[model samples]
Target: MGKFAKWLGAGVGFTLGGPIGAILGYTLGSFVDGFSIQDFTQEQEEYKQQTQQRTRVHATSGDFEISLLILASVVIKADGKVDRRELDYVRMHFVKMYGKDRANHAFKLFSGIIKRQISTRQVCMQIRQHMTHSSRLQLIHFLFGIAKADGNVSSSEEQEIHKIASYFYINDYDYTSIKAMFYNESDSAYKILEITKNVTDDEVKKAYRKMAKKYHPDRVQSVGEEHLVGAKEKFQKIQSAYEKIKDERGMS
Candidate 1:
């Protein structure tokens, strides 16, 4: 290993890990990158060492970074087309949360992840499996912040955000409250669902069918699948949510 490879490895690891792991990995990478390489062989050996160490750290962060990217991509693409306002919102949040340098790097990483089609459920499952409840909640909050950054929320964006939050097992109340901060007057998808908390069998079927069609992956295909990973999750969530409502109401 070379110095660059070492730094790259550390970045990959940091992006994959939890908060503490990410901090530690970033610190180590910063320190290592400050040193000058003496020769090609030494550099290669150093790079290899760094790569191994970094990968170990990354085992935790990669999923985190990927998850964020997936959500960001979905949020940006939620309303018909992605706009500069949304991109700026993302950049601002990144810089504010991670600082300028780290934010720049994170933006690049996030953009790369969103630029392609990936599996939203897989990413959410990875987060659910690996992250603590608190961490997951915090992530959900961050996402809510992202959605609200553009002044108001779109129906598509709200549905996607709700779906993401629910995957982390956030309840109807917290999800809606967070969502409420982004929108005024109207109830969120989560809240609307809650209204039917005691819905009849027919209503449950009707709602599910409506939501499935609205959030259907097919609805977003024109924008390309890269943008619909989150939509797919929302689509599935429509089913999951409907099931919960139906089961609670004793509806088949």
Candidate 2:
């Protein structure tokens, strides 16, 4: 069987339901032989408890993988065309997740999606409906990294990302915090910590502690190793933000 077909067949053994199922059904219906929602749901329910505890849910799961590719494709085309840098960045992540061969296949799929007009708002709404808040935050963070891969985030890309964050129901504070990681801004350090200069030293420390826990690489166990690696960048940003605050305050 072809790579896409193999991926779909393997996914059939998993609990692939809800919006994710709908999207995948539409995207891969032609390639996936004998695809049945009823059968998949029944099997999924049978193995629900066993899989629930061990399922890595996002990025690793078949549905999540497709969702990531769809969103990533949209982000890649946001600036009007795909840049080699952006493509390489995404390819590297996929390679790490699914090996070179599968990554190539997935990239082909992504490239095909990029060629078409994607209803990004609709996709984000579906993702938000099925994914957890943390998972959605990670998705936005991944998109930001891709935008910065070409050394600068275009105005159009930034606008699209902001729209995505809004659709994900990410609050202004969290959105700005994630943006500060990729974009250079005057109050980036404060924003990364999700705080303001008006806050006291103790509050700064508290914010740092909270952000540190939130963005820690260990928090992304549901995804693959590459994602944990990606989380490290966010974690580092939080650490750097705290250090900057400490230095400015002359606190040892």
Candidate 3:
């Protein structure tokens, strides 16, 4: 069978019945012709959940895949123009996380997703509803990876990412911490640990432990084995930052 045959027709279809699915159907059918962002979502329960502020957990790998694709679309358009390097980064990362065939299907859907005007808040809230906080944090990290794929993350791109983080309910510390990973700077280590330069050595150690557990791959293990690879990369970054801080502070 071809990749398109498996599009939204594979990987357990966790989001195949939700607004994510509806959006996918709409994207395939509409492809931006008289597209009403509200057309498929107005009466959906997801919109209701967004208003009622309820938590609906049990997100599958498929749902995570859909959410990642949509948010990546948002970030890619953040700078008002698409960069081929950024586009390739999305393709390569997806292929790395998922196998080649699955990644190809997702990339095809992503090609369509990029053409439409998606409601960033609505899609994010849908993900926030279904996914655990840990999974959502992983989403934020993946998005930062997308924005930084093309050398530097522009100011507009940064702003769009910050907006998406807010929609996901990720606080500034977590956001800046992930941001620190891509763009290394003087205080990137401290930022990665979510600590301040003026903090005491003990506080730095405490922050390191906290961040280590928070970013541990096991925390996001529920997403899937593929995602754990990304999670481990994040965990290693936290470790590397802690080591750097320890080296500079002479803390044994």
TM-score of each: 0.52, 0.80, 0.86
Per-residue lDDT of candidate 2, residues 1-252 (tens digit): 356656654533222555445444454433446755455455446545656786444334554567778788888888788799998999998787677987877776676556656677777876776566776788888898889999998899988889999999999988999999986777899999988889999999999999988888876666455466667877888898889889989977
Ranking by lDDT: 3, 2, 1
Over the stretch 143-246, how does candidate 3's per-residue lDDT look in tens digits?
Answer: 88888888898999889888888988989888999999988799999999998899999999899889988988998867788899889989999999999989
Q: Locate the minimum summed-lDDT window of 10 residues in model 3.
A: 39-48
How does each model score on lDDT? 0.54, 0.74, 0.81
Whose TM-score is higher: candidate 1's or candidate 3's? 3
Looking at model 1, residue 38 earns an lDDT score of 37
Q: Best TM-score goes to which candidate?
A: 3
Which stretches of model 2 miss by more than 4 angstroms?
Answer: 8-60
Compared with the true structure, model 3 gives a TM-score of 0.86
Ranking by TM-score: 3, 2, 1
**Once superposed on the true structure, which residue ranges of model 3 sit more than 4 Å away at CA?**
1-3, 12-14, 17-19, 30-57
TM-score, model 1 to reference? 0.52
Residue 100 displacement in candidate 3 (angstroms) = 0.8
What are the runs in model 1 whose C-alpha is more than 4 Å off? 1-8, 11-66, 186-252
